[model samples]
Target: MTTSRSFVLICTVGIFCFISYNMVRMPALSLFAESLGAGPERIGLIVSVSTLTGVLLKLPSGALSDIYGRRFLLRIGVVAFGLPPFLYPFITSLDALTALRFLHGLATAIFAPSALATVAELYRERRGAALGTYTACTQSGSLLGPFLGGYLIHAAGFSTAFVTAGVFGCVAMVLFYSLHLDVSVPQRKEQGTAAVLSEMWKGFSVVAKNTKVLITSVTDAAKMIANGALMAFLPLYGVSAGLNPGEVGLLFTVQACTSFFSKPIMGRVSDRMGRQPLILLGLSICAGTFVCIPHVSMFPVLLLLSAGFGFGEAVVSSSSSALVADSSEFKTLGAGMGMQGTIMDIGHASGPLLAGLLIASLSYPMAFGVIAGVQLLAAGVFWVTMKRM
Candidate 1:
């Protein structure tokens, strides 16, 4: 397939895949867990466990995609995305639902790095813009998913919401299967298992020793820490603060809308001006906006802050993936992205767990403040490291 066609097809796949993901993820997951008699801590576990799957699998999946091919893994990943939500309506208990979320998490664990690696390959010269555009498509899905999920839950119920999400997921899978070209087989001679292992290790070491990739991944992780916290708790907080489910969903929509609008522009700027400065700026924006979330009670004020967070998120993310791809060897792009996903998922998984503990013991301000502090420290460390290097 032509690069343009591939890019459009991939973006379309991302949109539907993420729509399915966020539909079940946001207001629905927490609220559904709540309905099942889960408390804050359990809810946090349920929310974060899906990301736990990513932390464990993303590196291996990405590495495997490098050794094998992108399309095969992508096919598997999209299947994971397409099928799981259909089972959600049948879930009977918290444990069962958590298990399903973990399963669903596998979809992203597989798809994300593979798809990213494909994009990196497809647009080696304009990676920043390409990655930005692809992510923006997913963010647009996020924008629509939560709002639709919340409205459906409020109007029709969880069963209807979940089933609808399943349908979108299936559509994404179909589009991906139909449109993505088969990965071209490499010309390398067939290798023994030991040789394969050695190649994988080489790729691993390539990414591990790259300071730029490491720093960028950690900085991205810091952003995700805040992002994950907001994603897990914001709906509950908004509801507690007297916002309805639809309104809470709109908050996510607003945040995603801002991100959708900002990422491609920021990505183009990163291509021109370099990535580190943009990454630093974006991290600062997220840290500040995140710390202020608990202080705002008005819906409009919260919306503005969420938008700020989104823009921050956009700038960092658009640059970070491109930076990782830039830092890796040509053959190890998937490994680099895998490492990035693994690190980011660690932060993402930790967010809900840490926030759950903090909120249980301290006030929301204190909880959010500590998360914000982590982002600031990461930014500071990243700046110092880059300067010294």
Candidate 2:
């Protein structure tokens, strides 16, 4: 397939796949866990277990894709995304739900790095714009999924919502299967198991040592910490604040909608104006908005805060991935992206756990304030570290 066709196909598949994934993820997952008798800490665990999967597997998957090829890994990823939601309806206990979430985590863990690497390879010159556009497509899923999932759960129920998510995932699988990706795989002279392991290790070692990649990933991780916290707790908080599930979902939708619209524009700006400044600006925006979330209980005000957070997310994300790509070796690109994913997942996984602990021990305002502080601290470190480098 032509590069343009391939990019479009990938974006299309991404939209559907994420739509499926997010429908189960956001308001639904936390609420479902609550229904199953989970408390704040348990709910945090259930939400983060999926990210834990990404933390463990993303690097290896990305490295393996660098050796084996993106298409092969992507196929597995789509299956992971498509099949797991079908099992949510059967989850009667928190343990089962946690296990399923971990399994479902495999979908993004495998697909994201490979797809990102593919996009980078496809548009070597305009990576910021390309990655931004691709991610914006995925964010579109974030935009729509919560809205749909919330509406479904409110109108029908969790079972219906999950089943519908499964359908979207299935559609993504079908679309991915039909598309012919013409990306080239690395050629290896040795075909032994040891050789493959050595190849993967080499990719890992190289990426792990790249200071720029590491810094960029960590900065991105700081943002994800806040994002993850919101995903796990926002629904509960909204309900407590007198919003319905549908309204809670709209909070996520507004956030995602702002992100979806801003990413490509911010990405192109990052391309022209440079990434570090935008990263700093975004971090500040996130911190400012995030620390204010629990201070207000009004719906209109909450929506505004959510949108601010989303725009910050778009700014940080649009630049950070491209920065990683720019910093990585061409041959180890997948590993670089994977390293970013792994670190970001670590931060993402930590968010809910940390927030749960803080909220349990203290209050929502304090919890959010503390997390927002973490973002500011990370921004400081990134700036100093980058300057010295």
Q: lDDT winner among the candidates?
A: 2
| Per-model tally of clashing residue pairs | 0, 0
Candidate 2, residue 164: lDDT:
96
lDDT on C-alpha atoms for all candidate structures: 0.91, 0.95
lDDT of 2 by residue, 1-389 (tens): 99999999999999999999999998999999999999999988999999999999999999999999999999999999999999989889888898899999999999999999999999999999999999999999899999999999999999999999999999999999987987987777889899999999999999989999999999999999999999999999999999999999999999999999999999999999999999999999999999999999999999999999999999999999999999999999999999999999999999999999999999999999999999999999999999999
Model 1: ten consecutive residues of lowest lDDT: 180-189
Error of 2 at 387 (Å): 0.8
TM-score of each: 0.98, 0.99
Those runs of model 1 whose alpha carbons end farther than 4 Å from true positions after fitting are 191-193
